[model samples]
Target: MNSDWQIELRALRYFICVAEEKSFTRAAGRLRIAQPALSRQIKKLEEDLRVQLFIRNSRGAELTEAGEILLRRAYLIFNQVQQTHHDVTIHSRHLGGVVSVGMPPTPGEFIAPRLLERSKERYPDIELRFVEGFSGELERKLANNEIGVAVMHDPAPRDDIRISKLLVEHLCLVGRSGTLAKPEYSLAEAGSYPLVMPSRPNFLRILIDGHAERLDIPLNIVTRSDGIGHTKSLVKYGHGFTILTYGAVISEVQQGVLQAVPICNPEILWTLCVAMRTDQGRKRTLAVIEELIQEVVQELVAEGIWK
Candidate 1:
């Protein structure tokens, strides 16, 4: 293996252009350079990496397996470079911009207010926008660059997104006060109750269903709702119980409108994560806001506001 080598950013950009155009001639035209020069740069890049990047024939160039990997990494490198430039530019000016953060309904209820207050006090010029949705919806928005950051629960793995574990939260069985009649419920006991739950593909629903399946217990789902308010309403009105994080029903639990019992006997746990697009150019304001989010969550956990 060739370990001693250096590749230039210009070469990476040229290679990416060729990979996208799939023809050295076309890429050279787009780059406003001679085809021979473009080809030489690509060849040098291949030599430095000691791998065949592209296969050329009558139909121009096609990326080899190595080329595909390099292309992905090159995009990340360019994005990081662009992000650094943006950060430097912003640092020269006042730290002020619209930083959008997405969160699921449950956590948002507790996190949004404190985050907004802290951000306002610290960075008055910066505008903080909150987008509320389920984890799947938030993840989609984050990936599409519609939002700069997302706090998600048990997010699935994605190549384009970077995930950082924030905390582990236990799932609980929620019902109207004095209805559960127990301090805790086992997996099978919880599954036996008529449940009001979110539809399929919901992060919480997926976690619950997977646990039930593994335990060979069938969930008696009586109703399906995607809305957090609607689900809580149903449970409040004596429709059925639902499985959710304790944070989701904290207000109701405090008001004595609902009760939450920890799921014991192989307790169900899900990781809360902060997710951001790996290819997105992060702004300085956004970075500070992300840090603020982490700080707020940590404080909430310490205060027992988010359990």
Candidate 2:
């Protein structure tokens, strides 16, 4: 238990290089230093931290659990330092850096392009990374810092996440164009149609089931899928009707390949939110991205694009 010790940033970087390359020779080549010197630096870093960072074998240098933890923290530290340097050296409107955001398929399709476009217009030098996933996958990425921000629908409450509700979106029935005789369906009437929807515990499935239970209606779900793309495709070929928000089907609807009609007699609504990990310090770039997301959502809602 070494309580008082100092580790240099250079040593951490050397360790990271070795861990990433997984070979002292390769790491030395990449760092443009002698292998012996890189080995010495990693050894010193381990001594200072009082833990074995790597397990060297014939294969290569493999990181121990301690090394893995240090690598993650080192990446954050270096990113923060880089961001600080950029913030201090660049103009306010010309902020340049990288941002990673995660979103579910529905909102992902809409927001990613718009966010990238707006980010490019305002911060020409900034790079945007967008990750598309389901609610569960995006939640895990956000918690692990794999993504800086996330947009989700019907997100479960978590103590470590701070969520901001961007809008309340109504659920609608998605079907192939000209397949349905009308543009609206009540909850009771929707029960009679063969429905293609996500399985239980998914946000949409949960909402629909809750309403069905409260209203004493039986849903005839013939097929189940977790992917938005598959659901849309199934509905497009007349496999079965699926439930979704207008934002989820805008592209297909406009192309006349699919038709989206609001469900009523008791409209079902799900809250769309942007969330971030509360355990970490907020970054300037993340703040800007969050604002951009909210702005884009508001603009789309106002223009009837995300209704």
Candidate 3:
């Protein structure tokens, strides 16, 4: 590649017009540029590339092979840039613009409970929408602007969105604070447990299943519901144990209702973050967002949830 290949779209367009018109006088008329300046820019473009892009004859100018090739690729690049601006403009203009929010299956799982609560409290008037999906789908929706924000596992955020670190969490093996002696737990050695985790086919469930397979143990679900309260209540009542994130059980942990045993083998460390729009908006928009995020982090920090 040429070192000076960082040419602008306008330059490519001027070249294309000159090539198509094949006449300095006529191309200038088509582009509304004075013939002399149009000639100078195209000349600079060719010089930067170290290639002659056109040949001048008695009648006009026509593109050489190099010019034709570059023109084709430039056309595609400019068209994509054009479409991106168009889409972003449309998103901000629509009334009651839809901001689809992605939810993790088990409500209040991970750092989700307080995050959701803070969002509602801070932006009570701002419309919020929710759709349940895994990290992968949520990333896609964020990229397409279908989902304005997502709460999920790390390493899935897109290039277009900004993320704020909230907590470092993991699935800890826990039972009602008192039952660590008899255990009767078989998979503890291989990182498996008869945990009341999200059901199969869900993202977290798939991750747990993979670990269990490697440990060569079966994960028997004593509680198969995707309700956060229900799963925590099950473990609190000593019906069974569950592997949940710090945010999922932080309150209970602090209250001594559910004590945690950090997973030793095949440990999982996950970071929770909040996703937000990158656009610089009026102070009103950012004020709400700032409070919402600050609340989640401060709440977790005050409770000593994240390490």
Candidate 4:
């Protein structure tokens, strides 16, 4: 609200440090500036605002009411400036920089290795970090800017986020090898088998459960798992069957440790999406990474690695 006060950001920063520390000497020490210079900057700041910002004494300086107001506004201003700088820096980066991408455990396990290898081959200077978690967690990380982009599932329609459909992967019933003679199943028939499934709130579980609900069929879920590894382990050992996209169990199925049967009453499909903040939707790095992921997914699908 101090419209007439044309204050330098550096001086505002100095004033904030003094206000927070309540001691000019300590603030100057923290700022690595001479105490006298810090004092002059704060004094100039006060003159610009035409108000007493601090009650100075030998012991310390306490903020006046105006100082408190500036403190609040300055905090907001500095935060915005920092965020702008970060975004601008990211946008300005060329072929070399760090980017974080989030993915669910299943796709992450399959995609991360190929993505890293290809990135090393193509964009060797660009450092890549992959964060693997459930879709719910990945979405939260994307929203908070903890990740630059995410490969996730069922990205609901939202104003602040932009989603691109990368794949509509077919879900199949998986179990210990030789347990099922045929490699195809109706959702109703699949419901008869005991299931090992991720608990509710998991995207896969939600999708599977929704299908069951829609068909008025109850799944005989024998055990619950929050992790893809555990879910695969449970199915491999003949404990029970589980539903997942073919890419998730391709290796196991090929090794004869697990057999997959496509679910076909409605043909369960897992819709994978690449999601990013709408504001940064046009970022070059994001576009490159997204394109690479789509390429990898299509290659897998084409080669029958992911069905």
TM-score of 3: 0.49
Q: Is candidate 2 or candidate 4 better by TM-score?
A: 2
Which window of 10 residues has the lowest lDDT sum in candidate 1?
A: 75-84
Instruction: Provide the lDDT at 293 for model 3.
Output: 52
The estimated TM-scores of all candidates read 0.71, 0.71, 0.49, 0.70
Greater-TM-score candidate between 3 and 4 = 4
Give me the overall lDDT of model 4: 0.83
Show model 3 residue runs off by greater than 4 Å: 1-144, 155-165, 181-187, 190-193, 215-217, 276-299, 302-307
Put down candidate 1 lDDT per residue, 1-307, tens digits, no spaces.
3788765899998998899789999999989999999989988888888899999999999999999888877766665665666667865766776677899887788778999999999999888878888899899767766677899998889999988888899989999899988889998898889999999888888888888888888889989988989999999999999998898889999999998999987799989988887765356777787788889899999998887
Give the clash total for candidate 3.
0
lDDT of 2 by residue, 1-307 (tens): 3788765889877987898789999999989999999999988888888899999999999999999988878867766676577657656555667777888877887788899999999878878877788787788767766678899887888998889999998888888998778768998887788999888678778889999999999999999998888889999998999888888899998999998888998899989999987854446677788999999999988888887
- What's the true lDDT of residue 129 in model 3? 54
Worst 10 residues of 2 by lDDT: 86-95
Please give the TM-score that candidate 4 achieves against the real structure.
0.70
TM-score of candidate 2 to 2 decimals? 0.71
Q: All candidates' lDDT scores? A: 0.85, 0.84, 0.64, 0.83
lDDT for each residue of candidate 4 in 1-307, tens digit (9 for 90 to 100): 3687675799988987898689999999999999999999988887778899999888799898999888877756664564565577775655556677898877887788999998888888777977788888888767766677799999778888889888898888888989988869999888889999888888888888899999899898889988889889988878899888888888887888998888898888889988888876656666788788988888877886666
Candidate 2 ranges with C-alpha deviation above 4 Å: 1-94
> Lowest summed lDDT over 10 consecutive residues: which window, candidate 3?
279-288
Candidate 2 yields a Cα-based lDDT of 0.84
